[model samples]
Target: MSSFGAIMVSFPGAAHRQFGKQIYTTLIPFGVMERFLMVDDDVQRKLNKRRVKSIANYILMGIKDGNLCFLSAITATCRGPIQYNEATNQLSIDISTQMSVNDGQHRFAGVKMALDTMRRKVDTSQGQQRLEYSEKLKKLEDMAIPVVIFGNLTKVMEQQLFHDLNLLANKPTKSVSLKFDNSDLYNAMAKELKNENEWLIRFGIETERTSLSERNRELMVLSTLRNMISFIISGTDKDSNAVLTLENYNTWKTDVSELIDKLFSVLPEDCNDRSRYIIGLAATIQGIGKYINYLINKENLSDEKLSGLKKVDWKHTNPHWNGAGGTFDPVKERIVFGGTGGGVNGIYMKLIEINGPSI
Candidate 1:
């Protein structure tokens, strides 16, 4: 039995001292875990509800019968140190001691919510549905998560531990992260497009997960494609808080892919080089994504307008782009004048204007 300040809570687990710290490990059940945990806001930031809800959705809606999921061990501590009996492999906390979480707060909250939701489903459901939900509830109740507990520490020590846990970790680059994450719908779509589209191959696709180098051969990166699809879905180049969706993912996929194909077709053979055409630049593709969204979402895009790209002069020599978004530099092989923010907006407007009459 557990909850902060409850009667003595005991469980079979193990503990050992590491670098002057006593650490404990255990597999905790969801029902017991929900009541067993607490948090000190002073040591951790306020919970992000959106993040918690995202995790909850993964738990409830994840595509599987067994609902296979994984979470790293939660890091935590008791208000007072826990005692362990090596012979029995039993761990116990004294009365009034509290189990507080230092990390994995979001996962903890999500699991608790999923457990509560399943219980409600079982209670309210009728007949076969109730039986089905009860089965699910049993499985959920049986779910156990690995947890790591630090020996009792003061508030200052907790703050330091939290800081080290968050700040010391290095995150993977955006491109690589998206490439490896098949769970995200957008990333999955991007991978499928990359393999199926020949246009991506001819111009080259960047898989190294870095910005294109001066002599780089790639026209676009995986992350860029993933973001482009997101932009197209949201129909905005600016940051948007609204959720994005596509009526049929393929319809927009074909439209945007055709738009890109046509735009690239109009350019000269030398257009693949970033130095030869501002259109070859990554920022230009970003702008194109916004424009494509605008065309579909605002202008009621048609076949003729897409085909009209054959008429636009996309060369860097075009005066429309010179002062508006900086100039092309042959020596550096990069944009010379306009910076990133100003440059993206410039390219976006230029795209609309370049195809204005026909559009």
Candidate 2:
């Protein structure tokens, strides 16, 4: 039932042998060929509505803005060998043949759904709105979906390809992603601090990944450092549009580095001992960083007054943390930190109480 004559185009390098041989493929428009793409009834992965809706929204936004581009191609394998005309350099695909999408089925479905939605909108609009929606619908129809078609692939080969593509794919962790992020001023500042601070390097900051190894001595994740730096510079855990400029970023970066250096210099000798002090914990560090911001902003504390934070006892054994939603386990010798919001607030209130009335 699908019309492939207008949409099909000869695409080279769709299939490559391990030893080095090139096979041909056909690139088709989703608008024309999506109905022909089939999934076997035995496939265990059911379509998730949440995922489909999310991806469909993303696709809709991209199509509206005219910036949707897929960097990776989708792949599908034929149940039987495809007819190829070597003399004409064309691959003949039969619409009746069972074509199993090996990967990107979700994306394909989302895009199809998004296109259908746009078509419906176009049908209901009037005048200028109708014209605009019509344009969008046309663009969606013409959108090229790159597909790598594999022919004569056995069931085992199809399963292996799917496993290799999805299961074996390596994605960078949050810390590594944040470390290399240049757009966010907080991430940039954290990376700079990691490079410049001898204390951070000595304490072993985790830059390459989020999770700490069992034997790893890293005291902070890069994402944690990012939040800390953001709070220290802007009195908030969010990037401020006011400090987005290069001049403001540099100034804030310098101030943050200086404040962090001073803060670390006065920390107790056991600051890095996770069992003794919450300072080593990421959530606790974020809470402390926020409290510091509060002191600098709300309490109008000078650098000298801020430095007086060293006088406060930050150990887990400090009675200031007892009761009032705070719990400590004597057996583990560690404060049982509450959930993120409650724990941060608890730490903040405790610090505020100890610091005592702005001097």
Candidate 3:
């Protein structure tokens, strides 16, 4: 009992492939995965709490709806020896020593957390609801993901494997991700607003780029619009429920489109070029979002509140933004806009101050 004896934990695969000299591919159940995964702290970096939470939430959402969630295979290495029965296509790993997971610790942790959450929920439910939850729990417990196991690797080898696994992998741009995602209603509604409204169509929105270039004619990026819409609708910066109803989508689209039109009406109209004014800057967009979020409950937009839009110096090189939206790089000969940080907040605070009580 003190030490886990040499009894092997068997991982059965439908079929197995050996890659290079020692890598073996296999499948592992969620049940067995939680117990055996050990992170070698010396070789791996610390687990990210946010990433773990996001993964857990995604799995839980899929499980609740009885849908399949997709993820890449997790990597693990044999500490000493791996018993491979070629005839049975099974991998036997010993639990006597610490066999560390070289990659995907956050994913493992997320799955574990999701299971724990279901267990807790199952304990509290009643009758048919309880039965449904129990079934979901069982389904989750039985689910398996492919695992890539390596013949005993040294610390250096594990480190190198980690590097190789993540080296060239790149996440898509935020705008592109929002454009393709059908999960959240906010992104969909934002896209709808852009497509339906004539003003927005003329203003131009970047569907792929993260930031607009100085010479770029587009005012806002799709991802930035998604974020602003998320804030406006949910009053926070988190993904809302996956609401796919056409009615709700249309309703929100109209309301948001009207609000955006109200903003353009208030700001100075640049006829020749939409990008000539500061109104379309990402920071300004977010600032306007924050201001509009405060007016969400109001039925009417009075002339008094929007008077500040006219007071603002809407030029691209206005001196007011020197240390506010961004600092001026004298030698670089350009204004460096702050990114996803204090710049947006600075603009919001200035808006609130200037838009105060119809002065």
Candidate 4:
């Protein structure tokens, strides 16, 4: 869309939400929304050859409203504070850690998306000239948006910024466990898990983990989806039976449905995309498993206590084992516990007490 009369558009939601409406309602028919492409970094990367087919299939099957993408600079800034200057048509962002130009590509994409939607024209002819102009635009992208992040932020200020971004993104905090209690095991596990935050974002929404009402639920859904996806993408023909046999378009739909009915049913009604919720729950549950195993393998839990444990309910285990041991008990969902081992030490029978009126 080419325009001499410059108009800037900014919003609190994704650029698609803003521009989609504008293009459909005002720009497209008028033929104003044309020159610039409104692309998110995340969207572009996932559009590659391999993912393209699956992504197309997913969209066609209505499996995902939005797919995972490369982390964008605009999204990366959620940890910091943001200020939008409507008057000057700028966004100012500040972070404790200075991000490089390459790292800021996604943020630049956000601006590009905005400019595209607003029908701003950039001179695209010169190689060096284009870089120079974009460099200047990059500065505007950074200065116009204000974001500040540090370990030393005041609790209240940090919380305020955190919440503002969460509400803006419509994030749910139902996935992270142990956030509220801050239990010793949870703290240790969370610290370790954060180390893998980058890789974890591939199948999960790392940015919005803390905003859920039940972080465990979010974690559960994510972990399961990742595992399921990996199983499909990396397996031998037999192992990846789901993807190999089903038409590509049906794969995501069936898998997502099963995942939702199994994992995220614990959540209350009203959440969008039950599939995303399932993915989050799976991630949280896997996190619990990773952490619990960390404790178990580290010998953090005493041998006696570990031995005394006959069964564990993964479902009841926070952040992990939501399927507990993955066994169905007909009436009960899933149960986990120790089975009999070769005994000279003898077997420990752990009795769990359940409450119900006697029939």
Better of 2 and 3 by lDDT: 3
Candidate 2, residue 188: CA error in Å? 3.4
What would the TM-score be for candidate 4 when compared with the true structure?
Answer: 0.20
Candidate 3 TM-score versus the reference = 0.80
Worst 10 residues of 3 by lDDT: 271-280
What RMSD, rounded to one decimal, does every model reach? 4.9, 6.5, 4.6, 19.3
Please state the error at residue 339 of candidate 3 in Å.
Answer: 4.6
- Stretches off by above 4 angstroms in model 2 are 1-7, 17-73, 77-102, 105-147, 151-164, 167-173, 176-185, 208-217, 233-248, 322-326, 338-342, 356-359
Which regions of candidate 3 deviate over 4 angstroms? 1-19, 66-69, 85-88, 94-99, 239-250, 265-275, 298-313, 317-336
In candidate 1, position 345 carries an lDDT of: 65
Residue lDDT tens for model 2, 17-100: 542323345666757756557765343257777777767766676664434335257777766446555566666566556678
User: What is candidate 1's lDDT per residue for 138-257, written digit by digit as tens?
Assistant: 777777888889988888989998998888988778787777775555666678777777777677767556577547767778877776666666654333443433336667567656
Q: Which ten residues in a row have the lowest lDDT in candidate 1?
A: 237-246
lDDT score at residue 134, model 2, on the 0-100 scale: 91
A best-first ranking of the candidates according to their TM-score comes to 3, 1, 2, 4
Q: Considering lDDT, where higher is better, how would the candidates rank from best to worst?
A: 1, 3, 2, 4
Candidate 4, superposed: residue stretches over 4 Å from native:
1-106, 109-226, 232-247, 252-359
Q: What's the true lDDT of residue 144 in model 2?
A: 68
Q: Where does candidate 2 clash, by residue pair?
A: none
Model 4 over residues 1-359: C-alpha lDDT tens digits? 11333343323321122212111111111122122122333312322444434432322222122322222222222233334554553433332322212122334344434443323324543677667556544433333332121222333543443455545664335334333322222232233343344333322344334333342333323323333333223221113334332235345434333333432343333232233232233333333233223333443434333333223332332333323233223353323222212110011111111101110
| Candidate achieving higher lDDT, 1 or 2 | 1
Best model number under lDDT: 1
Tens-digit lDDT string for candidate 3 (1-359) = 11445777777753344555487788778877866677888778889989998898888877655344576889987677677777887777776645578778888889898889899889999999999889989988998877877777878988988887777578789888888876566777778778878777887778988877667766689877876776555544563554334457677677677777766776766621434555666666776676666555452445456544767776656666676667766675444666755767766666666556332
